[model samples]
Target: MNVAVGCKVRFLNDVGGGEVIRIIDKRTALVKTFDGFEMPALLSELVVVEPAADELLQKKTVQEKETAEANRKKKPKSEVEYLTDDSPEVADSSGDELSLDIAFVPSNISNLQQSTFDMYLVNDSTYRVFYVLSNVIDDNHTPISSGILQPDTKVLVKRLTPEDVSKLIIMNLQAIYHKNIPYKPFQPEFYDIELDPIKLYKRGNFKRNDFFDIDAYIISIASTKREAFIRHLTDKAIVEAIKQKEKPAPVKEVKKPNIETEEVDLHIHELIDNWKDLSPGEILKIQLARFETALEGGIKSTTTKRMVFIHGVGNGKLKYEITKLLSSKYPKLRYQDASFKEYGFGATMVFLK
Candidate 1:
């Protein structure tokens, strides 16, 4: 980014955010910090700020501070407890030892549309990991953060802007894993982690997880082991024994119901006596099964010509589902709305002959 005299800018990787007072060269610039100090910073690391946008950013910060202070003075209320490593339910996990992921925690969960995110490199295992996190732009990797992450912990790598979250196409995670004690070695991994920027816009994408105190969007980068193991309250670990392969079971042909009558009542109440406790989905499932069975049998019968399935009109969901299934699965079968005079817009008639 090109910088001119008296340009407002913020340092990308540092705490000091101020304005650019002088342009040193093409690659360097002199920035006046908020603390009244002139610091030589790289032009690449200086993010230019608009005056109006900067005002709004400062206002938002003040509002957040006020809200935090207000909450502190208010009457104390019971808070929901989330899972932590100290919790009894989170005992030392036996399987899937080397878990690794990059977690994105929203800075403002209430206002997700404009919220920034604190990105974290999480190492949820016993292995000491050396990782380099990079940003991939124009097929080139720009180094962002690199460190040795301790076992079962996470480090905040970068605080992402709203624009950064929206344009998050991809990131590169490079890592090598090892334990201090005697252990099996893992090959160095170079992961090109793909991300959905569109989904990041939704508040539901960030969730309260076992790792972070705040809700986060965690994308697992790698795990060193995939072997399944059983855990018990003993010094020894258990492994499943090898068993002989059993003979394959014979597949039974589904017996389709013979639709001998001119009409098949596919309603839940008619098909089953105990459907009062069933959910709408369960009811629809039963009706579809009955419809399929009758249709399959009707098409193959020699005498049966026409079949009318009475699926009552309730928001047209069942009718839409039935028609869509028939059209896609039985393209050759001719079907239409049952005679309105007889069925009153509640049934489908199929020509099987």
Candidate 2:
């Protein structure tokens, strides 16, 4: 007899009746009862059945409600009184006594394995041993502990050799074929020696002729006239250090100053008195000079006020120059072609900052 996952089956014998939970293989089935205990049994020992009526009825009712809702056209009511007929208090406790059918199986323990430096006890009845292994142990070892194992925690079990058991008890040794093996100590690269130059030079710094050959240099210096070699190397090192100290620091780049001319707004009276008859270019030059003077004055005064360049609307040359200068030189100043009904396009408005 064969069973599959979620197959509905009932017990044939009286060894605790339940539904089949899963199929283990061709002959076995994992079954669970409504009371929550589970077991593996032969498929020949159970009978297949349709699902119970209570479950079928609940499913039918849900399907009917969904069908009704899908066919309906009306929008759902938002207010509680219109949406639901039941009182809030009765609705709250309606599902309190509902119980679900669930089952639990005994956890499988055969996959647990002993780790290096782990101990175990053998259970005589089942020929299986229970023991705590280091969580670091290989997965192949049997009767292993779950999660993190605490020191000195006794694990119950069976079916391991005495040598294997003894190896587990020894704290710092790896268990190999049921025997304890001591850990090897790691050695340091260089130990207990002074780095003298005479010893370095004799080791042949001249063979490779490489400047970065530190080890060869050390041996060569140490082998040859030791004191003189040390003094020469030390003096050379000092001279190199002094030369590095004498080298000049790098200089930072400086930005060039902007040389474009600025636009300035002259007083209406001043323009009439001293600048009215000048040509457009001459008037532009005067305006630029005035712009520089005004900028210096504003900076010194720390005031941000509007200055109106009252260039009348003749050919619009002066206004154009004024606006161009303002954009290039005094870009931070808020500028616009002056309002027509008031100053008209003949003047440009400069907002000082």
Candidate 3:
């Protein structure tokens, strides 16, 4: 690339561009940037910006060259001026306004029953506040607005309706504050405060009145001044109360019904009430059903190896039916007359396989 003095060129390895001032050697040239710093750059390290914007840029480059030459001609050369991004130093200021805080208060102190609740963001401390109020929904922090809050004053950010009160979520606050003194201000202090949703919006949850004239939610952010100790336990208790729901009582276990004794009475009076009104045939059928049920139970039981039925020697008809059922349905069973000492010739004991 052919280069000459007063030509605009860009630094190949760095961000900015400047005008070439003087060629030091075959490989190097001195360049001056717009911010007024001159440095030696390699000819290969710069690329000439083709078709420079106008002749005015070339004129400015020539004027800079003249200024550089005039400064060098002085008896004692002036010190070279370098540009940077740092602010100038200043002395620290002394004041009692050395802290910052964020707070909230209701606008109408006299009438607390208003439908539309007007709330204020109060800058309770002396330092000016630059703050952002973010609605923390889910895991995201969405900033509503950001601005400066003057000390000891309040800014109304919301005139909330009753529905707005319920729609309230977490308020994620981040702020940096410093005393607004002319001298070098105090180092900016950072604050991150998460306002509880219930306490921040729900009016019925207010537990104390020490910080405000009326019952209100006051958030304290890094303030050295003391206010009421927040009743976080109260909020916790309210949450617990809301979460408490009645749980159904645990189900009771039921026991399986089984034959109560080795000897089952098939007599109608023993099995049911008011058997005198039943016909003779109905009584016999009931007695046979009980006998069949008891025999099935004995057959299925692991521990019940024998069952004795006291059919009371009823004309031998019940016995004939019982014997027929055992022979046909339960071929694995055997039967004989029960003990004469206990049943007196009326009971029969059936044995299960």
Whose TM-score is greatest here? 1
Which 10 successive residues of model 3 have the least lDDT summed? 83-92
Q: Which lDDT value does model 2 have at 308?
A: 55
Model 1: lDDT of residue 300: 80
Candidate whose lDDT is highest: 1
Model 2, CA-based lDDT = 0.38
- For 160-257, candidate 3 gives per-residue lDDT tens digits of 55455555445556666654344334444433344444554456544454435566655444544321222222444433332342246597887663
Q: Which RMSD values do the candidates have, in order?
A: 21.1, 35.3, 33.6
Instruction: Give every collision pair in model 3.
Output: none
Where does candidate 1 stray beyond 4 Å? 1-13, 16-96, 224-353
The local lDDT score (0 to 100) that residue 218 gets in candidate 3 is 52
Cα lDDT for residue 160, candidate 2: 32
lDDT of 2 by residue, 95-151 (tens): 111111011111112222221111221111111111132322333333222211111
Clashing pairs in 1: none
Candidate 1's C-alpha lDDT? 0.69
**Model 1 clash tally?**
0
Q: Per model, how many backbone clashes are there?
A: 0, 34, 0
Off by over 4 Å in 3: 1-93, 96-115, 182-214, 226-353
* Regions of candidate 2 where Cα sits further than 4 Å from its true position: 1-280
Q: Once model 3 is optimally superposed onto the true structure by TM-score, how far is the C-alpha of residue 63 displaced, in angstroms?
A: 32
